[model samples]
Every structure is written in structure tokens, then in C-alpha cells.
Target: MLSELQKETAKAIVNIFETGSARGDYARVTLLTGDSGHLTYGRAQTTLGSGNLHLLIKAYCATPGAAYARTLKPYLPQLADIDLRLDTDWSFRNVLKEAGGDPVMRDVQDDFFDRVYWTPALASAKRTGLGEALSAAVVYDSVVHGSWIAMRDRTTAKAGAASSAGERRWIGVYLDTRRDWLASHSNALLRKTVYRMDAFKALAASGNWSLDLPMMVRGVRIDPDALCLRPPVNASAIEVATRNLRLTDPKMSGNDVRALEEALSKEGYAINRDGIFDEGLETALKSFQRDFGLVDDGIAGPATRLMLGI
Candidate 1:
């Protein structure tokens, strides 16, 4: 199971990555390059290779260790179900002894952790007052949510679907996020263990790996840079959305009457394909917004369209 510390680390670190970039990580080299990519690869080939080392490296190089656990006091219980045996006291010495002679592991250790230690927990503590809101997020009892995310990322990446970005169909998104690495070891046990050790170092450095869905640390085969981001989240101005929607049907926004008629059609109360939004449309819009968990304003804003999944 993921130790309590792992959950804290994962939440804090992922919070930074999510809110921080909308889609990216932290740190200098890799992060500086971009969230949608890696460093040496970008500089050299402008491409993320399909290699396990690169994937693990990418995760570590993006955030700080200290920051990983700094923001997760609320949801630490979710790490309970993960049966991670990596950091158990018994394996502590074994890992170190194993890495004792590996120069590459030793060399990257400090670089990996330095990034982890300095990154702030990124609770959006000061930005949106979400720091306090984050404090209230559900606290589940599971193991390795952090590690699970990491492993899941690997699975998703390996599927090469992330490269499609927002262009991916819903199935693409679902499949990429779900992957299994255990049955697909594809390599000798020693090599697998070595690669896993590297992943652990990266995980430990990020300080957030979840044991819950632990397969992520095994490795990734993603061909990143293959995808682009989804269209800017439906955050475009509501007026813009309204204008566009009105344009689609035209007769909808001529006046309050036409607009209301169109609005009613949009709200599914009446299907006046004739595009005039009338007062009835306003009433319908209000009801539609309420049902969709949006602000109950009669204005046809971006929120409405998104909820409708248009």
C-alpha cells in the first residue's frame, strides 16, 4: 500500500502540475522546455522518444520534492489501498546497496531531488484561494494515488494517444489513461528492477508517486509531441459563444423575442428551428443553466455549450 507520505507527495506535486500549467510540470530544464514535452529531446530532435528513461526523467525534472507533500494534508488517506512495497523498511538498504555501484543513478540523484525539494506545493494557495478549498477535497483511503497517476501517465503515454491531444476521441482519451505494465515486462527481471529503481528515484524526487495504480512507474512508451492540446477550454468570452451559436441558427438573436425563441430551442423545451430568441427563450435558458450546474443567468454563455458537450 502507498504509505501516507506517498499520497501527500502525489497530491501536492500533481496540484502544481495541473493548476500550474493547465497542462504542464515545474522545475527548470524540462519544465522550461514545456509541459507538452521534454528537454534534451526538444533541444536535439524536438521530439519525445518512446523510451522508459525519458518518461521517468521527464516526471522528475518537472517538479520539486519538498513541494510534493506540502499541499496534501487533506487527501492523504487515499494512499491506503495501494500495495506498494518499494519503501518498506526492509527494502531501504537493498535499494541503496543496489544503486551503490550505478554511476548514472548516483549522478542523477541530486538533480532529481533538488527539483522536488524547491517546488512549492502549488496549492494555488495564493492565486484562487483554492488553498483553503483544496483543504476540503475528499480524503479517500487508498494506496499510491500519486504513484498510480505516475504509472497511469506512463500507460497513457505508451499508448501514443496523448500526442493527439484534445483531438483525440473520447475513446482515445479513456484508453490512453488506462494501461497495464505487469504482464508486459518485455524485459528481464533485473532490467525491469533497474528501470523501476530509476522510476522510484524519479517518484521519490517528485515526492508524490501513488502506490494505488502502481504500474505507471514500470515505464512508458509514449511518443509525446504527437498530439496537440484540446481547443482552448470553452473559456472564450460568453458573448463570443453566444454570437457563434446565434450565427449557427441566425434567426435566434435578432431581438429579445427571437433570442428567446432560439433560447427555448436550445434549452430543449421547444424546437423553433426558426432562430428567434424570445422571452420564452430567456426563461428556458435560465432553466437550462440551472439543470446543467451553471449560473442560472439567461445569457447563453460558454458554460452552457460546454455542459451540452457541443
Candidate 2:
């Protein structure tokens, strides 16, 4: 069994990958193009497309003292149906974002993601004879990212079982194999996500098999302070709320627009990442909005950004 700090550190690594915060952003809602799991939300960004999002919200609504229980109860059916329209519903999205700030919602997400992701990941790690905390983390990331089984099998096939090849070597092979797969994937969005594997590879290379504290992940420090709810060094709260990307007469262009274009392309939209919010980008955004049942206003406001996972 892993120690508490090890577990939290492992989780913190993925939390940074998910929400850019070591403590996680419970209110984070993400929708990416071409992602099978659409409308991902909460601390771990559970996806609606996988029906796990329905399970998560149901658990929340059933819990006592849930701030949005009554308000969210009415939308259970749509959630159960994996309704893509919920992606664009401003009021519903607002409620979810607001509810995320509730203590009860945070507790529910902690419990839910633990039960749904962590527990299974641990089991998979134990089954593979991998006991190192970093190994557990690599497995956990695969589980959260989806297709743990496929990757596990692929790794075993290529490099032998973890028990046979040794845990460290097996994990190294897995990371390299997974990185190659992500880099060569037909989906452009998945290709951009090789950073996940790269981060894991960095941890492995550092001999952090024990997952000691004071580690740097994707430039964010994960130390005692960060795990205790303090912000990481050199990291500020992601201003996802105030960001607004839209088409203008002169065509707005910047890193934000470039990020949006990347996210849009990941969603399978045909758009170039020219860092310009031109009419073409707006048209693509509208198409994405229409596909997800959001308003086709061609605006990448809070609601739209939440959907785009940008």
C-alpha cells in the first residue's frame, strides 16, 4: 500500500495535468473535439460521453447538504442520456460551476474520483506487481485518461509483464510506447497530449520511485505546501473565468486564440492554429457549438471555453 503523501503526490501530478492546480479545480468543465468522452467535469474532469459524469452528478444530487442538489436534480435525465446539449446550456453550466465551489461538491468529487479512478488504478498496479508510487501514478493517469487495459496489454506485449521485466523497466517501456502511440494517433488532439507521457518519463528518470515531495511536474512544484491547498511556486490561479475568445472586425489573435484553435482541432474541427480568431475560426466554433448543442454564436466565452477544455 502506498503512503498518504505518495498517493496525494501522485494525484497532484495528474491534477496539474487536468486543471493546472495541484489542489485541483473542482469547477473545471472541459469539452474537446474528437474526444470520445465529451463534457468532462469536476476535479478529475470526468466525461459525460462515458456515462461516468452521470454517475458522478447522481451521487452528488443524492448526497445531503449538496448545494445544487435540488437545482441539479431536474437535469438528471439529460445527464443520464449523455445529452451533448448540456455542454452549451449556459444556465446549467453555471450551476455546475457554482456547485463546484460548494464544500459538499468538493467532497463528493474527491470521493467519486477516488472510488472511480484511484481504487481501480491501485488494483491494476498490484495485479501487475508494480508497487512503486510512481508506477501507481503512471497507472492512475492511464486509468483517468482512459484505456488502461489496452495500454497495459500493449506494454506487456512489447516489453513483457511488469513482474518479468521489472516494474521500473516495464513502466519505462510503457511510457515510451504510450508516447509513441499518442504522437502517431490519427487524432491531432491526442497527438498534442504526449506531454502527459513526457511528464511521467521525467519522474521516472529522476528515480522518484518513492514519489518524494518537492517535485516539479510540467513546471509546477508539488511540495508540502501545494498538497496542503497552498498554491504551487510560480503558479497562479488559471483565469479561465475571465478569458473571452471571439471574432472581431480586425480578427483577434494571440496565444489564447492559438490555444483555442488547438483545442478546436482536438475536437475534430477543421481550423488552423494561426493564433487569429478570424471568421474561419468563428465558423468552426459555431460548428462545434451546434454539434454539442451549445448556442452557435461563435463566441468562446466562459461557457464555450469550459466546453473546449482550453
Candidate 3:
């Protein structure tokens, strides 16, 4: 049976990829293309080239005799015919957003992640004799971001050493290999997103193979068994308390930074939407603070969060 920790590890991976943190299914529009070389959105990190658009349409069509699905049925051919890369167009995005509102998109995401990613990952973990929470988490992420065949091939190639060294050591080996693969990938965008590998390395370094202790991913500390409610659909911003947030703090990451950066950008402050609350982000935060009559302390506490509405 899958343990609760293992399940949360899956959710946590999704959190890191989709929202930067473990609280919500925040909508993100980072760029036409970024480090991942894919247009990304929602909790599942659905990318344009990854057949997710096709999956969404199929998912919508799967609903039996629903008007919404039927309304979109006519456009299925158009959706299918359009090049995934051309989805960068504003018109295409608007149509996609309309067709796949939050509820349907969540459904599609759950379906794809469960069927296409997590199920295979879980099965592969069993094959590899992996039972640790962190190991399962890593496998799931590999399946989601890369593919089962590639990860399996790599694992098999490294199996001799991993078998001798045990599961923990195998995880380290696998992560190192994955990092190298990403760094040397043909796609420059994929190559630049090696931070995902770095994050996993950090998790392994902490010796929490079972993921029983708190650890960081994408600068956010993930406490074992920590539970967070998914935010409502189309939520403009997330509410935060004074606790668990600070400039350069590991806890202050994920959607919080994305939200802050987006808000600042709207008000004419330039910042990267990488989701890390670095010094540049701190400076931008202070600029926003000074303008909004809040303390320019640069810590994203309750007051600052409220002022930014994120």
C-alpha cells in the first residue's frame, strides 16, 4: 500500500512543478517559452507540446452528453490540427483558456497525471523494489517531466552499482545521471531547467529517503505530512499569514514569489518570475512596500502579502 507520505510526495512534486509551493493550483503564464521550452499552466504543469492540449479536448469530450463538451466538439478538429507550438498566439490561448476553465483543466490534469505519469511511476517503483517516499516522489517526477522509458533505461544502466550500494545510494546515482542528462539535453530550454535536478539532489543530501523530515524544494520547506487546501479556481491571489515567510527564507517560495513578481510587474517593476525570493525580488518588494505605505522591510509577511493581495 502507498503510505500517506508517499502520496504527499507525489502532491509535493506537482506543487513544485506547477505552483512552486504546496498550497494551490495557481494559474501561471510565465512566457511563450521558458527554461522548460514549453508553455506551462495550472497544477499539472500542462505543456503545449506534450499532447496535453489533445488530452484536454479528449477529457472534455469524455463527459457524456454535456453541452459544454458538445460546444467544444466542433472545435476539436481545429484544436487537433493547430500546431502545438502555434499555441503561443494570444487568440489560441484565449480559446484554450475558455475551453479549459479551471474545473475542466483540473480534471484533465488529474486524469493525465494519474494515468500517464503517476500510475506508471508507481509500477516502475515496484519493479525497482523502491518503497521509500522520496524515491517514489523522484520516480513520479521523472515520469512526469521526462518519461518512463528513459528513466527506466538509465536506472537499468546504473543498476549494478545501485544494487551493491542500496536504494538510498541508487537514488543519488539516478539523480546525478538525470541532472547530467538535463544539462546536456539538445534543447537549450530543457538544459537550462536543471534546477529541478539540483532540487532533488538537495533532498537526497538531507538523507530523508523516506521523506519523514522537512526538506526544501524550489526554496520551499516541505514538512512531512503538511496538508494545504487547493485554492479556488481563478483565485486572483492567495492569502498568507505572518508566519512561514521571509526574504531569502527557504519557506518563502513557490506561488508567493510568482504572485509578488507578477503584481510588481503590473505596477512597472521588472523581475524574473522564477519563483525564488532573491535579493532582486527583495528590492522589488521594498519598492512596492514604499509605494503602498507598508514597511520597506522586504519580508513578505501578512501585511506585505495583503498589500500585494498574494
Residue 190 deviation, candidate 1, in Å?
Answer: 37
Q: Candidate 2: misplaced stretches above 4 Å?
A: 227-310
Per-residue lDDT over 160-239 for candidate 1, one digit per residue giving the tens place of the 0 to 100 score: 43334331221223222322332243322212222322333444345322323322322221122212232111000001
Clashing pairs in 3: 20-254
Give the TM-score of each candidate. Answer: 0.25, 0.72, 0.61
Per-residue CA lDDT of model 3 for 1-310, tens digit only, reads 6786668766675566556666435345434333332445556555544444444555557765433575556655544433545446665455555644556655665565565456556766766767777788887776556544455567668765445668877787787877787678665556655776677777778776666646656656567444443321111111111132346334357775787788788879989778778888888888877886554657554335434434
lDDT of 1: 0.29
Candidate 1: where are CA atoms >4 Å away?
Answer: 1-15, 18-268
Model 2, span 1-310: residue lDDT tens:
8999899988999888777788889997776666656667887777776566776888899889998999999988887666888877888888989999999999999987886678767866887889999999998887777656767789999999888899999999999988898878776667767888998998888888998879888777898666333322111112111335667667788888999999999989898789999988999999987886555767664335545544
The clash number for model 2 is 3
